[model samples]
Target: MSATATTTVTATDSPRKGRSGARPLHLPGGISLRVERRALAVGVLLTAAALALAVVLIGTGDFPIAPWDVVQTLLGNGTPANDFIVNDLRLPRVLVALLVGAALGMAGGVFQSVSRNPLGSPDLLGFGYGSAVGALVVIILFKGGATEVAVGALAGGLLAGVAVYLLAYKQGIQGYRLVLVGIGASAILIAVIQYLITKAQMIEATRAMVWLTGSLAGRDWAQVWPLLAVCAVLFPLVLGQGRALRMMEMGDDAAHAVGVRVERTRMLLMLAAILLTTAASAAAGPISFVALAAPQLARRLTRSPGGNLLTGALMGSVLLMVSDLASQRAFGADQLPVGVVTGLVGGIYLLWLLVTERRAGRI
Candidate 1:
């Protein structure tokens, strides 16, 4: 009943195990471990690629520094000018982009696994719309600063998620029901956001519009620190329940039969992923498609089942970093927000996804 239900064997035959070459390595104290070699390899490669992209991003800004210089600056061994450019200026923005992407990727994986659907993402869960509502409310009505807007978005996203959880709880929540309720809530939240925009002054409306695009611009240590702190806590918390989550993906009855405590694990994953998604949205204004696409991409790349949190996290970071690079250098002198780049790519990806789903008769 595991995600890798590739083969079945009866008691008269041999012990049941996946065809994934997942042999148990007996440790001292008779502890055996099952590691999916391909998946782990994929995760390692992704981490390397993400780091390489991060270095490229840090080094290729307006005041360009060589990759070596960027590394040296990070190590406190570069000249003051290079140090300022790499450490003081570009590093925070790059970190924010990487962290936000990783958070979104992991959260998306959790949601998708929980719902047993590829489209199960923060936006589909209404968290992104809810966060947008909070941010727009601050931008339009309160005339708030960047920090205030972020705080508002976080609060709004959490509230929206709570509401969806509550509404979907008919004795207990089902994955499809949760997604449906969240979609309904998202529609309402989208309307609220539009209304807020209509009521704003021209300047406020413009500000709101830009934020809605989900950029990583003007980011500094201030944004990076808190997001890092949140990811630090929530990432492990989510990963710790990965086994239970995979079991739940099989089905509630099967999971319960295996002592999986399906409901509690589901609740834990949902809450953790909510915090992760909201934190990422608040940090970078809901950069489109990372949550929706990262997990699926990682799954495909690894050719593995279940959440694949670590691989997704790395893929998300790399995807966001590449988009940020495209925004900064691909266009002419005029700078583009990272969100615009992501949106364009995400749109195409979503179309492809829809077509695939339709062909598969899963839509």
Candidate 2:
């Protein structure tokens, strides 16, 4: 009977022999990746879709350029009017949306995978509020410039993450404890933001409110370069830890038994997530729920287990671009902030998540 059970388990674990041949690519430090053809196909399709949507957005704005003109302008060939509209006016906003969305999505994926909870995103876990508080201080009290606001946001997010980690650390960190602490920290930070807004002068208050709502209205290369630099440095670091993160989902003991340094890996991933969230928030003022919803959305689209970082990043880019387009075109001439649209949509997604989790007995 034992032998029969062993045989059954082995057969179940083995990959099918004939369907889509498996390609095993070995890496340094004994890491390996199983490349699936179907996954590759899905990735290509998603990328194409995202690019198509971006083109549509660039060509459909107020000073609308033709799609052909947009493509030519992107390639440095269109007439000056087309060039001005696509290259100068529309392109930067689209780029910022893509980069920020990707950063937030990747951050969400890391946090969710590390905590082994769907509610473990930066927005839900307090990092976004923390960054917002930092930026608010610069905007209201100091009347600082854009660079200063970005730096303050980064500092605030890092500080918030450390505080929550220390407070949640008991014998060891647990998902539920970290989440609870983060939510509390987030609330406190939000209250601080509200107070600061109230004390500012009318003009400053209006600016603060718009920034808090996460607009990409006048975003230019100034916003784009900083976020691009941060994502370039941090995304690779996060992707490298994907294997260890997957191991961690099986519990610390199991991960440790598999030669993973559980605590160290979690700390590193958490730091990366915080930095990603900070950079994105600094650029776009906590664009609500891209971090919260992007990873799970990607997971469903790919039907893959674990983080699905690449797909998550793509989905985030698509979601933000679509939202920005909707905000500009949906309500006639009174252009809304991208954050407003996301906030409305994300609120619904949050409610549905809660209901679903409750039904599954995981809430």
Candidate 3:
């Protein structure tokens, strides 16, 4: 091989941990574990920031409780009134917001990695629109409640992912092809959603529109518990596949040459991402831009290339919570949907991203 070709091959074959500046720790039986310090540091800092924000968010509003009281109430130690407001009233909403953000962020990491595209996300891949279609069908046609709507959204997202996969599967699912097919599916599903909206009764249409905008208002333990359960199962599943995902970013042929089971890894990651997207959508109504922006933001924060699932998830949680706070207080008692805040911010971020990518000749 030519010198340059040989050099490229060597770099592509290098251990990813080394590229990330990961450190090794000695262990029993002559074993060792590698940890990426930057990702770890970023994760810890984001966790602290997210928790602090959560506490402050929980403490705000009429009949305000102190941060300490919010903490205590969360720990099951607060008095009845504080508990009523914190636990019964607010905690679930905040928790849902955090979980929804985390789920979407991690899912974004998965999709972006699989597609090798910065714009690859549930928001653009038709899953969100599919969830919306399912949800609108339930809300407008069947007159379903929150729980039913969540179930429908989940079903819709999964079906959308499958359809996108099937359409993109020609010649074994190329990265760009998957993204293009997914975006096309999203556009079509959006039209379906609009049609459903036109068919709804006035009251149902109002509620459906609000749900479409994605609010945390009236969220309770019901939303929290199911979403938490999904996150518990899916977070580790997706993170376990992160290394293989980063490998796939090197290209499928190279990854397959390394015994990475490229197609299997891609399929598993896609399924996991789809489920996470649906779960977040089910919980929070496909709150915009968190899926699109969180992973990218987390990677930049860590000074990493991309696909740090944990950091991305933490960053996602933080973004959603911050947006939730802004939505509640940014206006004077208007109490907008959390989706509105994220949508506005995400829109601006999207424009900046496009311009930045254009400058870099990547768009």
Candidate 4:
């Protein structure tokens, strides 16, 4: 049975009025949402920034279309050459980056919220490596096509998630235990990936290496559509669970007293997070630390508690698009994979997190 069936709200006093710039939106069945004005403004700004970066990426590639022409082409009013560059050549990769980043950001937010730990990201939790192993197996052993690789990645991620959950489950799940177990699992999976690479032929090994580096160089519409569809479906489902997730953050006993099925909700949320991670990994080859960094960055930007899914998604889109641009343009005539930039940045952030957490006596 679902928790919502028995969910009931009891108020001992009158509802407090909202603060300035916070509006109360009443919903069906007496539920209400207090929308924050500042957060909304931040989301809008981040979205515009993401769009601006997208335009820059589309216009500044090898062929170099004008920004105005990129805009006009998007609106169906540009020259055929510009249209081909913007729509056919560049836009698909940019879109893939945007969508993959958003998916990772949301997945990170979900895991972080559930674990109540800043380090509980897909990359840290072995899910990314698990997906990598699956993709590598398909690429090296089976010589599978793109769609088969995607399916393999998804299966690998889900299996990894389940393994972590079961290994961490003693009397329910503990955040630290889950993290530790996940790290161990991730180490094992990475060893497997290394062995697989060592055994592959030169051409297959090179292809696997490039994919594992997480490049957006040759992505096209085929990569974009399936990821877009997955994000479109899964994002809303996760967002809908935001309230329950927030409730769970108050601790299991407290949340249970208020009609939340803590275990079930956590399981569902973990499943959703794994699916989102799987989708992004399948599309972008486990681009590291966007998941770890984006949600934390978005929370800082919004100054809000809980997941801040909207801001996180927007921030992720901006981070990845900017990273992709830097990877391509930072070195003269030497294009780098997008993952290289994120890995370097995310490593610094992780070190900072470790020091901060240690200082706070939370690790």
> Mind giving the per-residue lDDT tens digits that candidate 3 earns over 1-363?
000011110112246757666666567777544556676678789999899989988998877889998889999999999989998888888899889999998898889878888889888889999999999999999999888999999999999999999999976778799889988998899899889889889999998899899889889999999999999998777766665666677888877886788888789889989999999999889799998898899878766654877788888999999998898788977888999999999999999999999999987
Across 40-87, the per-residue lDDT of candidate 4 in tens digits comes to 677889989999999999997678877888899999998988888888
TM-scores, all candidates, are 0.93, 0.91, 0.93, 0.93
lDDT of 2 by residue, 55-82 (tens): 9888976777777888888999999888
lDDT of 1 by residue, 265-354 (tens): 788889999998889989999788888999899888766678878778888898999999999889979779998998899889999999
Taken over the whole model, the C-alpha lDDT of each candidate is 0.83, 0.81, 0.83, 0.83
Global lDDT of model 1: 0.83
Alpha-carbon error at 70 in model 4, in Å? Answer: 0.5
* Residue 190 lDDT (model 1): 88
User: RMSD of candidate 4 to the true fold?
Assistant: 4.0
Looking at model 4, the pairs that clash are none
lDDT: worst 10-residue window of model 3: 1-10
* TM-score (C-alpha, index-matched) for candidate 1: 0.93
